[model samples]
Target: MIVGIDISKKWFDAAWQVDGQGRHQRFEYTDEDIGQLLAQTPEAAHYVMEATGTYHARLALRLHESGRRVSVVNPLVIKRFSQMQLSRVKSDRADAELIRRYGEQQPLSPWAPATDEVLELQQAHGWLNDLIGERTRLLNRREAHAHHAKPNAFVISQMAAQLQQLDGQIKTCERHLEVMVKKSFTELFERLLTIPSIGAKTAIELIIVTDGFRRFEDVKALCAYIGVSPTTFRSGSSVNGKGGIAKLGQGRMRQLLYLCSWTAKTCNPACRALYARLKALGKPPKVINVAIAHKLLRQAFAVATTNAPFSTEYA
Candidate 1:
């Protein structure tokens, strides 16, 4: 039996069907109901669920404990598929049924959770990003206040203290993240870091988001996966504008690359020359930034694929 679980914060809906059977069963969302359903039919082949925030993890854990094969599908992919035939209606029960039928008919890829250590790395990266963003905000506020009127002594002092705390936390997080990356993904880490603008955080992010670079065939595919590939917008007899990136893949990876692009094109001579050439040819600064990010992304992919440090010569 293959079953699809549509999970929510409070409840879960189940759609189940057997391989050679004509009838299918749909169960309304409920807790403790899985145990009963499994008891009635214990020969489960695989149980699939759509990835919803923390909502689906607990149920997945329970199902796994009962020796059921469980997989989570990316919700974005599911949503796209769901819109094809139905194109309009959406409901918990209907979604569950859709997932079940799709699982049976579409030969969709199954989702596997990352290993514990990788999950830890991702969590650490998320925390570090949060701290960095908060610190930036605090610093911006401090700058604006100090430049404005004569700032109140107490308020300025408090802001300074908070900024210092955030700074300390950010450093600590980076240190721990570096240690973890070196410990877990050593050779790949060392090789990739040689590339300009690449760091422990960015490297770890690519690893986690790519699931150790397993999915894509090569570096260029990885570039597309990273979402730096330029997309086109066209009309009847006109190419209107080439806007920002697709923003389709790993968001953290995209954001990290954007930050790297700004520095990479400044500090790395090869990339800086590319930026200057683009600008002199009348390409916008933002366009140059995107192009630089694209190069860095492809270079990172090359480093991973060839097990070599990124080389400027490309020879």
Candidate 2:
């Protein structure tokens, strides 16, 4: 038995199949509702739900605590499954049914909650990103005000104060994140830092995202998960296009890797050689950077699995 749940901010819809027929129910986001739903389903039934940001966390955690089997899948996977089934209905009820059928048909691994340290690092990283975003907005506002013909001194001073404050907050958050990583993943953090162009922040971000590298077993899967793996688009000679990243995974991580690639191409021996060879072949700058980012991920994975620091001599 499998129950598919479509969760929202306030409620969720659950669907399952019984006697070759469909059964569906809606419930509020509460302990009582969750208990009732569990009672209604078979003890052996598997519950599957999409990872809907933080909205699904409460229910998923509750389910796991109650000893029910829970599988939290990526939303992209469910979207692809829906497309394959030619699903046209776009309601919560339909989504729940689709999720149920997906669980029943596809092989899925159970989701594991992140450890306390990793979770705390993730929260801190998210806060840092938010602060960075705010800083950017403040910068743009300052620039706009500067060109305001009159350029009010009062507004400019306020913006400057705000920017300084945000910078301090961002630095504090980053420092806290590094401390958390060092406390829980000291060896991994140090190892990752040995890779050229991979600084403390990048290493911390990778650990937080990969849950200390327990989420993936190999470099290939990690590359794909980080959205740095190459994707081809060619059906026949008549229909062909340039290959690029799939861009179906973590966008923020992908962006961060891309930024790191700029430095990696110059300092990292392996990446430098690859960049030179690709540049010789006339590959575009963006294409070359993506490749370097991919290479960085490969190095990160290798060091993580081998429990060793990266060495330029190995290049």
Give the top-scoring candidate (lDDT).
Answer: 2
Top model by TM-score, which number? 2
Model 2 Cα lDDT, one tens digit per residue, 178-246: 888899999999999999999877888898889889899787888888888898888977869889898
RMSD of each: 4.0, 1.8
Q: List the residue pairs that clash in candidate 1.
A: 12-29
TM-score of each: 0.78, 0.93
Would you list the C-alpha lDDT of every candidate in the order shown? 0.76, 0.90
lDDT of 1 by residue, 1-315 (tens): 667778877677777755665334444345467676576555656777788977887677767777777878888868888877665768877787777776776665555556788779878878887898898898889888888667888989999899889989988988887788788888888887888888777887777677566667877677767788777787777668766677677666888888899889877767888898998999988788888888887777777778877777881
Q: What local lDDT does model 2 show for residue 240? A: 92
Per-residue error at 220 for model 2, in Å?
1.5
